[model samples]
Target: MLLLTLYIIGITAEAMTGALSAGRKQMDTFGVIIIACVTALGGGSVRDVLLGSYPLTWVAHPEYMVITSVAAVVTIAIAPVFRYLRKLFLMLDAVGLVTFAIIATQKTLDLGHGIIIASIMAVVTGVFGGVLRDILCNDVPLVFRKEIYGSIALMVALLYHSLTTLLHVPMDYAVIITLVAGVLVRIAAIGFKLDMPQFKYNSPEH
Candidate 1:
């Protein structure tokens, strides 16, 4: 039950970010709703499809879509407030990332999958929605950038794996640790400007 609630919160936060992205692109109401849904639910849908988990969450639970759509519209109504809450949005996004990662890890493991597949699901759930949002907004995909986005997902997955599988820790404890650590590490990365190495080629300019 708690996991389900966290999942909803994660998607809602993601949807708000998506709504902001759509506003930045000056998209219409329909476009904003579409982008919001894609950003909030796209990652989980992708994960389920890849894993052959039928009956997508939004399909099984239409309320989630409604939530995303409403969030998008509300964001449009108060768009200016977001400009002052950029840091708050980042923090929410970080929490959502951890929530998605933790839920993905738990669900995949519950399905009798191995750690590797769980890790992949973690990354898929953590980053794919933002990737879709960026692509739809005609911006560079954040996961492909020189940031610790994918690393955070992997770290959460690894921590979950180690705690539950190896260390024999309880699910609640593992989740708490992973969620708190993931958010802190993400915030630290943001604050310290920590990033992965980027590739630069001296090719001729077009």
Candidate 2:
């Protein structure tokens, strides 16, 4: 139930982001739909494949795809009303990241994985779809650039592992801690205009 809720929230956020971004780029309805679907399902598809879970989540359920499509259409139609969609996208994405990170960590732990593996899987689940969507749209992935995106994922996973194993915290408490930490970090990042350090490479010898 918890996992399903997280998945739904993540998909909704992804759909909104895709719709806004695609509409901004002047994509047609079909293009918007495609981007939304890709954004919503890309990460879960990769995670399921890696975990050897056949038929993928959306493939088996199918409702997720339908919901994503509808969300894209609605977002596109309402784009004008939501003039600050870029800010909305950032907020929703932050919530979705926290939800996905917690879900991934719990799921991996349930599958009897080690802490390290769970943490890695958590990051993958939290950021992979956004990465794919940005790459396909010819933009830098948020996880790889601006804000403390990947760090939020990593911190959430580590907190889950630490609270659970070291302090022998209950799963529920661990999940709460993970979610709170992630959300706080994300909110702080946005509130303070936080950004990751950038590299400046020397020009190649001519």
Candidate 3:
């Protein structure tokens, strides 16, 4: 139940971000809705396909789509206030990322998969939706940037897996710990401008 609630919040937050991206590109309402839905659900869909999990979340529960669509429309309605809420949006996005990672890790484990695969799927589910959103918006994918986005996802996955699988922590406690830690790390990274070292390559002119 906890995971389900967080999952809904994550998807709604993600949809708002996607709607913002679409608005930046001056897309129409229909386009905004499409991008929002894709960004909110694309990662999980990809993960399920890769893991061979039948009946995707949105497929199993169409209400999720309705929720995402409503969130997107609300985003569009309140687009003007976004400038003041940039930090808030980032915080929400971080929450979404961590929640997605924890949920994906749990899902993979429940599917009888090992921790390594769970970690991988967690990263995928945390970032792939944003990747698709960026591609659609013609912006650079954030995971490729020198930020701690994907790293946070992997960290959340590993921590959750360790707490539950190795240390035998209860699911609720593990989820709470992982979510708080991941969100703090992500916000700190953003606030401090901490990122992985860039790999710069220069070619000499012949």
Candidate 4:
């Protein structure tokens, strides 16, 4: 139940940030909502499809989509407020990243999958939604280039796995620890300007 609450918060926060991106591009209202929904839900949808996990689905639960769309519209009304809140939104995205990672880890483990699969799903859930949002906005995907981004997802997944599988910690405690630790790691990366050297290559023209 705690995890569920966190999931809702994560999606709402992500939707609002997504709306900011749409506003930057001056997209129409419908485009804002669409990008917001994709930013909020696309990661989980991709994870489910990849893992063949049904039942926990956006298609089945339209309510989540409705909530995200509403959040996006709300953001549009208050876009100016966020203009001075770049750091806040970045932190919110950090929260969303951890929430998505924890949820994906839980779902994969619940499906009787192994830790490795859980780790992959964690990355997919934590990163892909923003990737979709960036694609829609014609921006470079952050997961592919951002500082310590995907690394944080992997760290959260590992922490969750260690707590539940190795240390035998309770789920609630594990979730709380992972969430706090993951977000902090992300914020610290930003504060320190930590970034991977991005991949770069060019082939000779044929």
Measured against the true structure, the TM-scores of the candidates, in listed sequence, are 0.93, 0.86, 0.95, 0.93
What's model 3's lDDT at 183? Answer: 91
Worst 10 residues of 3 by lDDT: 141-150
Model 2's alpha-carbon lDDT is 0.79
lDDT of 4 by residue, 68-96 (tens): 99999999888778878888778878888
Candidate 1 wrong stretches, greater than 4 Å: 203-206
Q: Is 2 or 3 the stronger prediction by TM-score?
A: 3
What local lDDT does model 1 show for residue 79? 86
Best by TM-score: 3
Residue 23 of model 1 has an lDDT of: 84
Model 1 residue 147 distance off true place after TM-score fit, in angstroms = 3.5
Off by over 4 Å in 3: 203-206
Off by over 4 Å in 4: 202-206
Least accurate 10 contiguous residues by lDDT in model 4 = 142-151
The residue pairs in collision within model 4 are none
Question: Mind giving the per-residue lDDT tens digits that candidate 1 earns over 1-206?
Answer: 66677778888889998988888898999999999999999998999999888898899999999999999999999888888998888888888888889888888898889999999999998888889889989999877772587899999999988998899998888888888999999999988999887888998998
Q: Sort by lDDT, best first.
A: 3, 1, 4, 2
Report how far off residue 172 is in candidate 2 (Å). 3.2
Q: Clashes per prediction?
A: 0, 0, 0, 0
Clashes of 3: 0
lDDT of each: 0.88, 0.79, 0.91, 0.88
